[model samples]
Target: MHPPGADTVLVRHGDLNTKSNTVKRYMEGLLAENLEAILADRSVPGEVERRWSRPLVHTTEDAVEDATAAAADTFGVVSASPCLTTSTEKDRILEVLAETARARYDGGSFAVDARRADKSLPYDSDDLAREGGAAIWEAVADEFEPEVDLDDPDLTFGVEVREDVAFVYLEKRAGPGGLPLGAQEPVIAMVSGGIDSPVAAYEAMKRGSPIVPVYVDLGPFGGIDHEARAMETVRVLSGYAPNFDMEVYRVPGGETISVLVEEMEEGRMLSMRRFFYRAAEVLAERVDAHGIVTGEAVGQKSSQTVQNLGVTSRATRLPIHRPLLTRDKADIVEQAREIGTFTESTIDAGCNRVAPDRAETNARLEPLLAAEPDDLFERAEEAARNAKLVEP
Candidate 1:
């Protein structure tokens, strides 16, 4: 139990499989704003703080109790309770209000904001509001003396239920969450004109790491196909963040790798990665970004093995931040779902087109560096310098 000034209980809406980082980010974003509110008043002390996710994790009764405990824990909290009313169904909302209202003592007024995210739900929005409000009144009337009017009730509660989740909170403060702002300096993404890199760029932006997306338009990977994908992805991402910028680096590496593949000993994956990082570094230095961010997940495939990661990492002095590094396929899929990137990336093109069927997983650094064709790095640098600067 917490002694509370302002208790906040975060609720997990559904089985969306949202990452802890994203949730944490959203909560922080909310708290930062709410804390400022408390601070401005100078009446609430110790500031607004959040407890761990509770409502969604616990059963209905337990979630309520947990919320109460968190609120109570705050230093200056007068009293706290997890709001017990939230639902996409108006009937459910009314049912919850009628059911939970019995717990309310005298001197408390309640409000219902019937928020509807799913238009397909059975009832109209207004119907939900009226029924829900009526339910609370009925519950109060049945359980205790009817306070003539709710205008001056001792406590005020609110309910917000939408598609996939509901939030019942006494207070709605802003969240500290935005993209993890300023974690990494701006970097130019490989922007494969494919799904992964664009999605990766979006993830990078959310973290507050500025991006200079670098799309390598080889002109041979089906002309308008690559360019169209790159342009469209940047457009969607820019909608989320207006101030984004991009640079299209045209590397003829796709064709070059095809020719080189014949000369290598089944290590084409490593060779391709080498070219990618090298090209990326040239752009990174040009833009002054500290490191490159990629969508690579470790061991999801052969090319992501420990040895492959090590070899690819060697191509640049700047650190590579693989946000998806340890994520499983399911986790990555879920993230893509949240950002609207999954479908787009998948439909654009496949990554393994040029990769070997069974690329070397345990690439030795000495042989990997020593094996490749000459002037690959030099060609990459020149190509990066000429990549297009697309506005996000």
Candidate 2:
């Protein structure tokens, strides 16, 4: 049994268990360090320990909620729960289970879910669950009726018996499950003021890549409002990884847009997208990033059609990762809301002033390739070099 007044939070692993032994150990170490950093950043006083192949956060009773929240928000975590630790003794387990249930469960259909990680225990999972359920029923029966519903229940009391101890918890807070951040190489994320781009960058971050957010400043075409919204969105994203200092790179892009609009009338949007990719490639080289992430979705805009996407993709050699490629606008918006970027993105950034009334949807490769500017790489290099870093 844990000391009196001590609170423990059980942190569940996400996909880290699927890796090889060596990789899993390495990632688990990183996950533990990240969890500590997240708790410290949130001003929650807690100590993290690895036990039973999982991270356990030991905190004070008052800090348990914050500690659990911090753990849940961290990458590589599937869920987090503030649990009560007790001995593996059957009677002690039932006593703690009943006490926890009486404190948390308020007269409703409930279920007892028990798991025995230690097979050495005399009782199996089913026996533990049955005994635990009966204990809880007896404890709460005096006040109100407590019906047991295995299929679906209003309240669920979970019990897990380990080698030397057991854990009793009522709720599991869901986390953004994926590999730990910094697990993959860095990537240059082409972010915009709109909802889609920020969500795209977040998905990349969730997949273990620390992103270098590049905001192309389309001068007269994209107004000050647009730049402000984009910066705010990046700031919102920076909150997710509080331990990492996310630097936003502002690239000047108005000159390139002006040139493309004048040089190609119908294919200007395609050419503009190409310019964005080319600039991202240059920034990628500067940052040693392996890929570029964008918010492009199929048929979302005139420039994002299948053929046009392929044509624009040719502008850079690096892999272009569109996390929202197949996602609908509504889904993207919902994800944006979930990630705390929707409100910042909703701020009225004026419409694209330079977009053609009827932009080319299915652009052919040969013609657009031939019209490509010879100084395109040079311009990209200049933009990348001149990019100002905004610290969040």
Candidate 2 per-residue lDDT, tens place, 1-392, comes to 22224399888986998898889888888788889888887789999997636789999888888888888888888999888888999999898877876677777798988989888889999998999899989988988888999999988888878898788888788899998888999999887898888999999988889999999998888888888889888988887787776889999988887787677677777877788888899889988999999999999988899999999999899999999999999999998888799998975543356677778898997887677676766787788889999864
Q: Mind giving the per-residue lDDT tens digits that candidate 1 earns over 1-392?
A: 21112233443321212447686556444433433342333333333334333322122343334434433322122233344434465566666656555555343455655556567778765776677667767777755655434465444445555565555545432221333333336766666655566667766765557676665554443356656766667666654443234434455555656655667756766777777788889877776877887778889778889778988888888888787777777766776666566665564443455566667888888777678877768767766766655543
Give the top-scoring candidate (TM-score): 2
10 residues in a row with least lDDT, candidate 1: 1-10
Q: Against the unseen true structure, what C-alpha lDDT does each candidate score?
A: 0.56, 0.85
How many residue pairs clash in model 1? 29
Could you tell me every candidate's TM-score relative to the true structure?
A: 0.57, 0.95
- Each model's Cα RMSD: 14.4, 2.2
Q: Residue 382 lDDT in model 1? A: 68
Output the lDDT of residue 131, model 2: 91
Which segments of model 1 are wrong by more than 4 Å?
1-184, 193-195, 218-223, 246-252, 348-351
